[model samples]
Target: MEWVLLVIAGLCSGIIGALVGLGGGVILVPVIVYLGSVGLLDGITPQTVVGLSVIMMIFTGLSSTIAYMKKKTVDFKSGWIFFAGSAPGTILGAFVNRGLDLPSFQLYFGIMMVFLSLLLLIRKHLKPVHWFVKNGRKTTFEDGTGTYVYGYPIWFALLLTFGIGFSSGLFGIGGGSMLVPAMLLLFLFPPHVAVGTSMFMVFLSALVNSVTHISLGNVPWLYTIPVIPAAYIGAKIGAYLNHRLNSDSLVIVLQIVLLLLGVRSILDGIM
Candidate 1:
């Protein structure tokens, strides 16, 4: 039964991660913590939770990237550029994660969740930065709707993804929550391209993060058995749906869920 629940959690996280390019750690971390709180799981700590979440993200990112690749949605050049910044940031964040206790970790993670939810809420209302679009490296993408051109300054992108990667390593949330919004609002990336490229970056960052956590003995190998495969399958499903469905409604739902989870985490930390 416990394994079943873990599998379900992984599936849900993978689906949502691939669907929105958030890498599903947002969902998985809270669920794991909740289960631990309820005595359904044992030996839960901030580091272990984050470690497990990053490990699961490996499969989530890889599976989704493959699916998005088939659709020609991934921007590999930008993805590589983003990775250059994220890799070092992830290593730094993993080191930082070792210093956090449960309450502090919960508090900070809750704050992050709330911020990401709000970012998504206001993302559509945000406009692309004129400077980035005008002066940055330009690229074009075409979909059924039309042709879209978008770009960002290389220096700014590096700085931004470094922060994203740091957050991913610290919280195991895959950094997509921040990256997708930044891409869409500041860089003028098409929505599909933003998500696809975000996953690619997530994959690379997760690889760095997982390695660091593994070296630190943070991952609980037994707990990861069910999650990895389940998340992989779920990511495939989500990528398939991304091609056919309107994700605006799903984003709204995810925002609400994240908001609720954020509040719960904050209260848990406080009490």
Candidate 2:
């Protein structure tokens, strides 16, 4: 029954992560925490949950990235730039996260979720208003099937991704919740491009972070095994759905998920 529940949760989380670039941790972490809080799962520490979540992210991120790649929506150059900053941050966060107590971890997670939710809610007002680098490349690029007309400051992206990667490593999230919104609202990336690129970055960061956690013996492999296949299938479905939705609709969907996840996480954390 526990495995069944985890599979169901993994399916839903994968779909959301693929569609919105959230990386499934937003959904999975809270659910596992809630189960453990209620005594439904034994010996499930914060470290254990974070470790398992990263392992699941490896599969979801890879599968979703592949789906997006087929549609030619991923921004490889931009994704690599983000990964450059994210890698070290992820490593540092993995080591730092080992020291947090369960309650403190939950409280911080709740606060982070709520903060991300608020950002998404007011994202429209935050539009791409400033260009930090005037001499940056302004040319449009084609990704086989789709062409993206976007300009991004490489320095700004590196700065932002470092923080995002830190959060990903520390919180066991994909960092897409923050990355997707920043790409769209700040960098003006096309919605599909942001989602795809974010997935690629999440895959790389999560893979490294997962290895770090595994070396520390944090992952509950027995419980995490069933989630991978279901999450992979769901991610493909989500990527298919992402291509069909318009930007405004996608933003609305992402905001709603962030809002709900935020509320639930906060409530769980305080209680």
Candidate 3:
């Protein structure tokens, strides 16, 4: 039964993660923590939860990246550039995660979740920054929708992704909560390209972050046994759905879920 629940959670996480480029940790971490809190699972700590979540993200990112690559949506150059900053930040965040207790971790994670939810809620109304579009590197992408041009300053992108990576390593929520929106609202990236590129960066950053967690003995290998394959399969399904579905509705649904989860987590931390 416990394994079944874990598999279900992984599938949900992977689908949501791939659909929106959230890397699925946003869903998985809270589920694991909640299960542990209710005594359905054992030996759950902030470190271990984060560790397991990131490990699962490795598969989520890889599976989604492959699917996006087939559609030619991934911006490989930007992914690499973003990764340059994210790698070091991920290492640093893993170290910081070791210092947090469960209550503190929950509090911070809840706040982050709420912030990300609100960011997404407001993202559609926001416009791309003029300075970023005018002065930064420029590229064009063409699809059935039409031709779109977008770019970001290399230096700013590095700095932004570093913060995203730090958050990922700390919370195991994958940086896509922040990265995807930034690409859409601040950097002028097309929606599909933003999600695809974000997943690519997620894959690379998770690789670095997971290694750091493994070395710190934070990973619960047994817990990850069911999650990996489930997440991988779900990612493939999500990638397929991305092309067919109107993501605006999904984003609205996701916003509500995150907001509710964030409030619950915050209350849990306080109590």
Q: How much lDDT does each candidate structure score? A: 0.93, 0.83, 0.94
- TM-score of every model? 0.98, 0.91, 0.99
Q: Which 10 successive residues of model 1 have the least lDDT summed?
A: 124-133
Residue ranges of candidate 1 with Cα displaced over 4 Å: none
Ranking by lDDT: 3, 1, 2
- Clash pairs of candidate 1? none
Per-residue C-alpha lDDT of model 2 across residues 167-251, encoded as one tens digit per residue? 9989998899899878876676877788999999999998889989999998998888778887888888888888886546765
Candidate 3 local lDDT, 106-197, one digit each (tens) = 89999998998899899888866878978899999999989999999999999999999999999999899899989988888999999999
What is the descending TM-score order? Answer: 3, 1, 2
- Which stretch of 10 consecutive residues in model 2 shows the poorest summed lDDT? 130-139
Off by over 4 Å in 2: 142-148, 246-264, 267-271
Look at candidate 1 and tell me the lDDT of residue 66. 99
Between 2 and 3, whose TM-score is larger?
3
Clashing pairs in 3: none
Error of 3 at 68 (Å): 0.5
Per-residue error at 113 for model 1, in Å? 0.6
